[model samples]
Target: MLVVGAVVLAALMLPGVWHLLRHGLTIVHEAAHAGVAVLVGRRLSGIRVHSDTSGLTVSRGRARGPGMVATVAAGYPGPALLGAAAAWLLSRGYALGVLWLLLLVVVLVLLQIRNWYGLWAVLVSGVALVAVTLWAPAQVQTVVAAGLTWFFLLGAPRAVVEMQVQRRRVRRRGGRDESDAGLLAGLTHVPAIVWVGAFLAVCGVLLAAGGAWLLAAWPVTGITYPPWADVPTCDPMCPSAASATAPGLPFSVCDSEAVSTPPEIEPHSGRNESLSLRRALALLDVCARETDPTGLTAAEIGRRLGVHKSTVLRLAAPLLESELLRRDTTSGRFRLGPGALRLGHAYLSTLDVESVAAPSLDELARTTGCLTVLTVPDGLQSRIAGHRPAPGTAGRAVPRLPSVVPLHCTAPGKAILSVAGTALLERAVAGGLRPVTPRSITDPGELRAEVLRTRRRGFAVDDREFDPDVRAVAAPVLDHTGDVVAALAVVGPAARMSAAAVQEHARSVVLAARTVTRRLGGAGLGPSAAAGGAAEDLRARRGA
Candidate 1:
């Protein structure tokens, strides 16, 4: 029983594995904020769980006070508290109760999720709980419960340690580190490091207490046999061999106490034959990359995995049965199956355009030292949702206005228009092709031609169209289905943004948009769409 928890605790140290696992902790973190906010009489605005495992809980109330402080401080301690509850339930021989509690927790969080990503995360977690509760064998349920308890109890302190590490790194770079500890420091006049130490101490105490409870709840005492493990074989020479081999034998008896002459389980023991989750994912990854119609053979897969071909097929059996991988009967080759597409669709459904585009938008602003913005089509017009200026030009270039501009004149608008369907295009042209500058395309026919050019180039150029002395270049942000969802643009003074400059900047904007597109689970602009633009003439700009 402890082995399961110990394995989960050890897995947390692996970076790749930690990425997916940390989201559960983040959910708990944000739930604590939401719960405390409600208890303090604050109106919970909503919660957003980002793709990167960060979360936000907003509540309407006084910005500062004991209530606000409590809400802010609740996040870091939430998982530990939950783990303690799970430990208590486990100690009482109520393992299934812990699983039910998890389901309840997810349902509550799902009710408050404001963004698609949060909703998807909560829903996925809820589905897993439901599956385990309704379908998993009793043994699997107990192991899962113990593992989850370990994850929460141990993951809390680990998160705090990482938070402190990120804080220090940000401070080293002269950036403001508004971590929970730092926020607490500001509110309570306590040093951030002191708050960090306090969080670590509390979590450590909880971990110690929870661990003891779990240990005491083992099968020898209050617990029973896992009820699913295969019957163990005992030494025939042993006097107590028959009783030791019996079902419902305590773990102590089977593990070491009663079985004095147990057989050894070596690294290659048949009893230890199992495919780990990480290895399964690795197999799927390599198979997914096989573009050939028949896919890679088992021998090739084994070569890539650095294992024997027979071992490959043995390990792949579960994957084939689960429908996550499809094997060709005739050629004995393998490829990703429909089940993988379902997983991909699930991931794509969780993506948010703004959150996905934010990093590239910020990087573009920093790289070009110009005004970079993300725009989406609002009816026939283009709306500027957000903007960032170059490093030294924070308040310059563009006002912090969430303003809409004419689709025919602005770079972002034209970029979006380039790929828009006939209905949207006709509606946009019906808006009179309004001119914002002397050089703007006002005639509907001329505007249609310009959009065609933008389509071929994979980017749009304003060229003093939006403003008399301003030039901008933009590219469309597409989704997994190749539909434009938004546009990315960079604007600068016409003097510094000559035709050559526009060409250079256009490539950067196009590549940035494509990067954001892929990150958002988009298929990206195909070779034909990016041929002359992103491929041949890479856009780049340096703000002056």
Candidate 2:
């Protein structure tokens, strides 16, 4: 059992090891891009991992300028960083870290990015380190060193034992015995001298690069006027704040801080100023909800708002600084930022209506085992409140609720009108009931009769009326004062939803509806209340 458990644990851990090796390369690559972008004074937009095989980092467009050549040159840092981390870990006596470093080297080779030459250099360095460790037999200065070197010292002996076992098995089966001899010969092969030479070569190259980078920095730091220093000096065309580079750059040598000027007093603006701000706010509201703000361009905003591009820029400048909107450097698109997320989350978190209706809709789906829908009366039309798909039936390509559907054709829509009475039905008819589906009741008389029947029966059924092949039965989910706040429905494919199944689940559905209504502090009767004489007949058939 212990052996079995150990084997199972190894099997489980193997995949995780492989996944880490693969994913670590991606992390390092992306981190290098982000770090380089920051170093070159480009504010990062975001890093996106498209898949295991692809990723990209978006930064401020100014990073593409000539002063930022290091940004492009920085790609090699990822593999080199991985190699350095591996060396650090190996020095601290961690075997798994060495394996991870080797795996990262494999990933860099497999990716074959544009900077393959640099990656190749890093990979060869790591491979050389592993080779050196394997070739050199440990000379134990103490008993502890001998104990610590078990895996390395006994590795050859263990391989010999395993090779002998395979040979005996091959002999018993009348197979060739050359495999054991080859393994023994390979194990004893002396390649330590070659490995030591490779390791020394890698160490020398790394030290040379490090020394060059440090010595070259003196030209930029020690000089009173460096070539790059002119780039940081701001003029009227360039804002003084623009000269402020990334953190850790010497602030003392460069007087780059911008001084603020006092605003000139102006005459009081008229009442129209307040009205204009309100109109601007209203236009933003429309843009946020009705349109894809993410797709908006500066010219588009200017066109829609009937303002010049400069005016649009001036108005949006403060918002940009506060992060209310983010501009995508790649596509030059604008979108609501973290500020919008915070505000939207706060509004959604405080919503009581959805909270009251959720449990009832959940229970309806659980009891009926059919897609349950909820809708709120939005003027003459109805907007879906929420939808809960039936158990074992997720990913069935079912449309979400909260989508606008014609008031007269859908079960929840009709259920709302039924409970709201004839006035609401008359308003719906006057509002124009366009035929959405073939089963839609277009005629006023038919719709009126259906509404009356729904009121009498205490529920409504949409028989492929809203959509073909979809049937729904709904009961109005009432609120605290017994006013229908929303409607709940059980919907499924018409073929599977037979008359008998409907009848069988009718009492359970009605009971579930009543349970939710009562929980929400409403006084209402489910379908069972209107069954009258047929209730006993239905119950007896079910042996209840």
**Clashing residue pairs in candidate 1, if any?**
504-539, 504-540, 507-539, 508-539
- Model 2 residue 197 lDDT score: 39
Q: Highest lDDT, which number?
A: 1
Give the Å error, residue 80, model 2: 91
Worst 10 residues of 1 by lDDT: 535-544
Alpha carbon lDDT of each predicted model: 0.75, 0.51
Encode model 2's per-residue lDDT on 398-438: one tens digit a residue.
Answer: 66554787779988888787766456777888887788776
**Model 1 RMSD, rounded to 1 decimal:** 28.9
lDDT, candidate 1, equals 0.75
lDDT per residue for candidate 1 within 66-129, as digits (tens), equals 9999999999989998999899888655677899999898999998999998899889999999
Candidate 2 TM-score versus the reference: 0.32
**Model 2 alpha-carbon drift over 4 Å, by segment:** 1-351, 400-402, 525-544
Give the winner by TM-score.
1
